[model samples]
Target chain A: DQQVKQNSPSLSVQEGRISILNCDYTNSMFDYFLWYKKYPAEGPTFLISISSIKDKNEDGRFTVFLNKSAKHLSLHIVPSQPGDSAVYFCAALGGSQGNLIFGKGTKLSVKP
Target chain B: DAGVTQSPTHLIKTRGQQVTLRCSPKSGHDTVSWYQQALGQGPQFIFQYYEEEERQRGNFPDRFSGHQFPNYSSELNVNALLLGDSALYLCASSYRTGNYGYTFGSGTRLTVV
Candidate 1:
């Protein structure tokens, strides 16, 4: 069974609009969460992360919100740009190695 | 500084054959981890190497194994490849203390026919 789930497979938004990607997890042991962005034929690059202790973490136009009680998280990109069109992965940080448990990922298409 | 580097950007192998992929960690990083990403799926952890030892592993079969050199470079070996084994193999480097998040390589695209 997958520990992390991104129900939406894709999201489309107009440039300069807001893009929201959501994720959920079944494992309570997950104490930290991260977001990664990937382009074609490239590895995932870390974007932002939030710890279980905080409900939110922000970086530039990207923000990650966590709800520990619901075991859910969301990534928000304000004033989304065309360059943001790519696959976004939601990951939970846990285990002895702190290896990430990733969702299937949601592809965002920001059109001009 | 150079980030994690993986070799053989792409590879092709026959079923039942074996393959080995290599990786060199980022500068000053001492730990290396591998993940497999199938088409349309998230990356799954394979295992991690620290201090030339296998520190942690995922639910992969024994056919999947790895080695970490003293210099923090690593190799992932898979025996008896299957069609399902074809995927983008990613190598990520990090510090043992977890202070630095991982830096990942573009990955090796392996195809089993």
Candidate 2:
């Protein structure tokens, strides 16, 4: 069973526009969420995270919003640039366990 | 300062063989976690080691085992390799402190024939 799901396999957006990626989780026990960006042949890099206690967290051009009631979360990148093109993964942490359940990943393409 | 580092960036093994992969965590990090990523899928947690002991493990089989040295480096051993064992093995390093994000290595791609 896939606890975390990224419905969209890929997304495309124009530069300077907002790019939104969505994710959902079936495990209600998950309380912490994180987003990671990965480039070709490279390891994933942490981008942003949001705790269940808060509904939203923002950093620079990236913002993450969580809706506990819906068991859904979304990542928004404003003024998307070509450099933002990569695979984005959504991860969730449950309880005190350090393991993170990840989504299949969404390939984001920012067109110049 | 360096990020997590893994050795033998690529390897190939035939069925019924054994393979050992190594990892060196970043400076001052005390915890190490291993993950197996199949093609077109997200990474699956294998296990984690801290303070020279295993603190957590995922739902992998006994064929997968690991050890952490006193220096915080780790080694993952897979016995009786199967064709399905072929995947990219990723090593992540993080402090034991709560809520800290893990830094992952480039990964070692293992191919089994």
Candidate 3:
């Protein structure tokens, strides 16, 4: 069974959109969550992360919200630009976690 | 400082052939991890090396093996490659103990026929 799941395979948004990507996880032991972005033929680059202690974390135009009771997390990118078009992956881990558990990813397309 | 560096940007091999991929970790990084990503799929952890030892592993088979040198550089080797082995191999570097920040390389594309 997949510990992390990104149900949406793709999402489209207009430039300057408030794009929101959602993720759900089955493992309750996950104490940390991170988002990574990847372009074609490239490795994933870290974007933002949130500890279980906090329900929300914001960084500039990006914000991440975690709902512990729902086992859901969402990444919001305000004023999305064309450069934001890429694959977004959700990763989760727990304390003493050896490796991260990653979802299938959601491909975001921001049009001009 | 250089992030992570992977060699042989792309390579092709046939079934039963073997392949070796190399990686140089970022400065001040002591741990190395390898991931495999198939098309339309997220990267999956293969294994990790720290202090020149295999510290953790994923659900991959024995065909996936790796080595971390004293300098913190690493190499991933695959023997008896199959067509299913074709994918993008990514190398990530992190600190041996502590924070979870990781730096990833561009990755090497391996195609097995």
Candidate 4:
């Protein structure tokens, strides 16, 4: 009964390469999507977000793409740096209370 | 300003004991939400407080309760702690009307033996 799902448990990429993390959601009422990056002993930090109205949103080295018809979204980071290594969580904003439903998370490792 | 502050960064308790965790919201934020994150799992919503009242709640049991002070700070209290209650508790703060996202605290780790 997980509303949001991250199929991949982890991902590895070389520095200067592109890293892609994927997520899926079962609820169609989700109109807003966000990505968060978390480091050890720290809280999740908001990365980027996209409204249902838009198919994509980009910020600096990070880009988020949403496909409403497929109920899927992906986060792309170009020129991945070692500092980018952390856990990534995909969250959806929906439900009656507009609370965020989060995916399990994908740990990203960038090797320099 | 400070983002969100959670107290007693870590705690250990025995079964049947009770525990209380505290949270201070970010500057100018009026809404407080608590979440529980178990091992290898994402954070799950426990409840949310706005204007000193419980505005929304998740599927947690009655053993989990909370309160919000007039200053927008919050406390999460759990009664009759069980071994399963061990997890990292997170507190998030945001504007009353804005639900787009939140600012989260580092979280308090609670261990029930």
Off by over 4 Å in 2: B97-99
Encode model 4's per-residue lDDT on B8-86: one tens digit a residue.
8999999999999999999999999899999999999999999999988888999999999999999999999999999
Per-residue accuracy of model 2 over B1-107 as CA lDDT, tens digit each: 99999989999999999999999999989899898988888888898898898888888999999999999999999999999999999999999834457999999
Candidate 2 lDDT, A1-112, residue by residue in tens: 9999999999999999999999999998888899999898888899999999999999999999999999999999998999999999998875354887789899999999
Candidate 1: tens digits of C-alpha lDDT, residues B5-93: 99999999999999999999999899999999999999999999998998888889999999999899999999999999999999999
Report the error of model 1 at residue B57, Å. 0.5
**What would the per-residue lDDT of candidate 1 be over residues A1-112, giving only the tens digit for each residue?**
9999999999999999999999999999888899999999888999999989999999999999998889899999999999999999999886877888899999999999
Q: Cα miss at B106, model 2 (Å)?
A: 0.8
Candidate 3 chain A, poorest ten consecutive residues by summed lDDT: A93-102
**Which portions of model 4 show Cα errors greater than 4 Å?**
none
Off by more than 4 A, model 1: B97-100
Report DockQ per prediction, comma-separated.
0.71, 0.61, 0.66, 0.69
Interface RMSD of each: 1.6, 1.6, 1.8, 1.4
lDDT of each: 0.94, 0.92, 0.91, 0.93
Residue A48 displacement (Å), model 3:
0.4
Superior by DockQ: candidate 3 or candidate 4:
4
